[model samples]
Target: MLDSLRKAAGTWVAKLLLLLLVGSFAVWGISGQLVTGMGGNSVIVAGGTEVSATDYRLAYDRQLSVMSQQFGTRITRDQATALGIDNQVLAQLVAGAVLDEQARKLGLGVSRDRVAALTVEDPAFQGPDGRFDRNQFDYVLRQVGMRPEDYLTNREQVAVRQQIVEAVSDGLTAPDAFFRALALYEGEDRTVDFVVLPSSLVEPIEDPSADVLAKWFEDRKANYGAPEYRKISYVKLEPEDIADESAITDDQVAKDYEASKARYTTAETRRIEQLVFASEEAAQAAADSLKAGSTFDQVVAAEGKSMGDVQMGALTKDKVPDPAVAEAAFKLQANEVSPIIKGSFGPMLVRVTEITPETVKSLDDVKTEIRKALALAEANRILLDVHDSYEDARAGGDSLQDAATKLNLKVTTIDAIDRTAQRPDGTIVDDIPESAALLAAAFESEANVENDPINIGSNGFVFFEVEGITPARERMLDEVREKVVADWKVAEVAARLGAKATELEKRLKDGATLDTIAAELKLEKQTKRGLKRQADDADFGRTGVAAAFGVPEKGVGLTPAPTDGGQILFQVSEVFEPAGADASTLPEQTRTSLSQGLADDLLDQLVARLQAEYDVEVDQGAIQRALSF
Candidate 1:
């Protein structure tokens, strides 16, 4: 019951309820506290419905607990405030109060019998026998810190509010026009004729003069700036690093092998085929035919069945399921048939097509494996001790390297690496423990600050310290001349290609054939038919497809190629609408999705109306006091 509640709390409905009930109490400053001096314990008041501070605190703590479980750590009060848990809890309370008030105005009430029925029908209250259990109900409510009467009251209120929600959103469906428009938009297809203009088609670009190159470098110096790098030293402690296979004695291996002998044993199995008959006389007659001259498969065919219908794949004696069949099948040799026997289902003839003998590995065969397993187990058992020893040395004011050396652990030093773990030469630094986490911590840490160790799950821990920092700086033209020249050439090629594609598009618009343009440029002309609006072609690319769809039939446009700086000159040849199928024929999933969207919109509007009608008031001061602890 407790587990079910925890799982239920993670669902979307639970999350939405939390968000709605937890009003913006933290954001509602004392100045906006509408019920500030109302006194008493009420934190929120909607019409005649009031939420006490005790109730608000209970909801806040419940939400906090759920968040803590999700994050796998305890959430502090300050963290909860930062996450707006207080606001969400208060908002939910406010929304519920408003709904309750409106329900009261509408004279909406749930009978005690109805609440009782809902309680009894709840799956969380079911016992192992699948019936409502009073003990389970009491236990689950106690675990969640709710009293019986309080739970019943909350259940009754929820039932009442549900009445309004159902009236507002039930039986809603997406309009036919909206569905048809969506179907048309999603199912439209197009075909296009396009030519890719490569950079080679552009006129040759000469090397820039020294002055021109220098000016270009100056304009884009920031692009060539070197990233900030940090030099760090770290020590890693893992079980594999400390495990010593040689330390595991033969006697220990023998003992472990004895304790887990079943791990090395393989069960015998056989490929058995069966032919069951209505009576012993029929099965005997089939066996006689098989023994005379007919093959098992021929006999099966005579019975209007194939081998697949009779062959039971490999099975161990215990896996045969029928005890009589299992005993008879195991007694026969390969290719040998058993006498007609009565199985659980009927009288059947069994044939053993293949047999696998059981095998057990000797202690000598698995001695080394057992030794390694024992060694790893011992290492894991003592890993915490090694970690503590290192911490003790650190507490004694020892340096990271000194402490690691004392424990006989190696310390790795990274001379200089940027946030991306790249060296100055642009090569990625390799084999760093927890590379990403280490780099992020190294960059955020100062040289002399004592940084916390990164726990790499159960495997190990990595302790790192930033040694030195190199600030980012712009590189001189001389330092990046080769790269700058290559980039400049690319930009020049792109500019020329763009101009050429524009010329080609204008020609196509002026009635020149795509084939003629392709032939003149010595490029391939490609046509893609039945291309949907959302088609993602590798060579044509999405932007090119969009450009094609944007133009009318016979219109030409250009877009940059997905790869390479080349551009695509395309002419839309045809546009096809969806077939004559009506929106009512849409897949059930699509219709349900659309209907759910409409229902959600209706519910949102109803909630807004209720909130306004009730004139919700929040006691910010009361909320602050309630969550102070």
Candidate 2:
């Protein structure tokens, strides 16, 4: 009932009500301290409707809970304020109040019987048997900290608000001219004749003199500066680090293998084909035909059935639907047909096309697997003890290295890594556990601070500290001379290519055929047809395609190629307009989208008008007090 109301109300009222409904269900039991702190204050007042401070707090806490789940951590009040969640909650509450005030002024009311029917039909209150259960209804209300009377009142308000929303925006549709213009814009096609000018066509650029190169380096020195790097040292505690497969005795391996024998066994299966008939006489006649040297394919074809219609791929006996069919199918050898069997559906003839025998692995085949599983299980059992011991040592004032050393654990040190976990030389620092989280924590810590361990799920922890820092600095020209020269060459080539493309575009505009130009330059001339506005092609990239469509038929344009710093010189050859179909006959999905857009516009206008009439007000002090805790 609420979901339907939300859809009918469009976005403004829909979003406001949705947040209220979600908060009511997801957040529970506001503290008495907060209620007392808020004392007699209303967070928002619009006309005759008022939102109490308690309501605002409930909504804000629910949004915070949702954000914490998304980030896998708790969110502080400061974080919520930074995210603008506090303001957003206040705004939603104000919108709801404005709508409620308008509904009250207009005297819109829903019948008690209608509200009762919607509650009983709500799936949230349904039981296992799919009918409204009194116990489930009571339990859900208690869980959300709402009384039955309060829930019904809320439901009644939603229905009343929906009446106002639907009256203004229901059955709205976009004008036919709007859809026709959109269709023409989207469906128009183009054809272009083009030539590719590769960078190789440009003459080799001469190297700059020493003075010019030095000046170039001075102008762009910042581009060659090195990024700040940090050296991080960490210790990881994982189950695999302590697991000892060799310590698992042969007797334990044998016992585990015997207990889990089914894991190593494969059940027998057979490929079966079945043909069901209405009566025993029809089935027996078909079976007799197979016995008289007629092939199964011939009998199946005579019944106007294809092989796929009857083929049931390899399945175990238990997987077969009918017990009678299962028993008979296993009894027959490969390529043998059975007489009419009374299947669950009807009398049927079955044939076994192939058989696979059951096979059990020998103890030696899986001994190592069993041993490793047992060893991992044993390691998991004692991982907590190791974690506790390390914590105890830390509480006793031991450094990360000392604690790890006492436990015989290895501490890994990365010599230098940037924020992206890359060395100054641009190679990735490999094999860091939880690199993203670890690097984020490492960059935020000082060299001597003892950071808390990051829990890598339920299995392990990574304790890290920053060991050293390298401040970023400008690189000397000599250190990056080779790269500078290479980059200069690429820029030089691109500039040359742009000039050549501009010259070619002018020649084409002056009535030179692409074929003649291509023949003169010994380059291939290609033509692309049926290119839509959204076409993605290898040679004619998005920019090139857009250039093509921007011009009228026979107009010339140029753009750089999607790859290789090449250029495309093209002239539009043809244009295809959308077919002259009735614009009213738009696709159902397109029509619904346009209608919803129109509805949203109407709802926005209505809400704005109501806000102006109701004179909505917000109490920032009350909001701050509610969120202070």
Give me the runs in candidate 1 sitting further than 4 Å from their true place. 1-40, 208-220, 229-416, 431-469, 499-513, 542-557
lDDT of 2 by residue, 542-619 (tens): 888888999999999988899978998998999998788446556889878787777767766666667677776666
Candidate achieving the largest lDDT: 1
lDDT of 2: 0.80
Displacement of the residue 217 alpha carbon in candidate 1, Å: 3.9
lDDT of 1 by residue, 516-617 (tens): 999988889999898878888887778877877888887888989999778898888888888864586577799887887778677666666666767777
At residue 165, candidate 1 shows an lDDT of: 70
**lDDT of prediction 1:** 0.81
Task: Give the number of the best model, judged by TM-score.
Answer: 1
RMSD of each: 8.2, 9.2
